[model samples]
Target: MLQLIEEIVYQVTGKNGLTYDTDFVQDLALNSFDVMNIIGKFEDHFDTTIPTRDVWHLHQVKDVIDYLAGRGFTQP
Candidate 1:
C-alpha cells in the first residue's frame, strides 16, 4: 500500500523518499488541492470514496495507511 501510495504521490509531486510519518503539507509542501488530488487518486485506485470528514483527518502517510488498513487494505 505504501508503495502504491508513493507511486501516486510521485505522479503528482515528481518527488519521493516519503516516510510513514511524512506530513502531506509540511513534508511534501503540498497545498489543499494537491492533497485532495492525491486522495482522489487513492480513492480511484481502491474504488472507495473516503468520507470527506474522514479525509481531512489523514494528514500523514501513516494516517492514510491506517485508514485504508481499517477498511481491509493490507500493509504488505
Candidate 2:
C-alpha cells in the first residue's frame, strides 16, 4: 500500500523521491487543484471513496496510507 501510494504521489507530483513524512502542500509544493487531482487518482486506484470532509486530514503520505488502511486496504 505504501509503495502504491508513493507511485500515485510520483505520478501526481512528478517527483521520484518521497517519504512517509512528506507533506503534499509544504513538501511537494502542490496546489489545491493538484491535491484534488491526486485524491481523485487515489480513489480510482484504490476503489475507495474519501470524503471531502476527511481530505484535509490527509496532510502527509502516511496520513493517506493510514486512511486507506483504516478502510481495509492491505499491501499485496
User: Which candidate tops lDDT?
Assistant: 1
Q: Give the TM-score of each candidate.
A: 0.89, 0.86
Span of ten consecutive residues with least summed lDDT in model 2? 9-18
After superposition, candidate 1 runs with Cα above 4 Å error: none
> What's the CA error at residue 31 for candidate 2, in Å?
0.9
Best by TM-score: 1
Per-residue lDDT of candidate 1, residues 1-76 (tens digit) = 7788899999987879988999988888888788888888888888878787898888899998988989997744
Note each model's CA RMSD in angstroms: 1.5, 1.4
lDDT of 2 at 7: 85
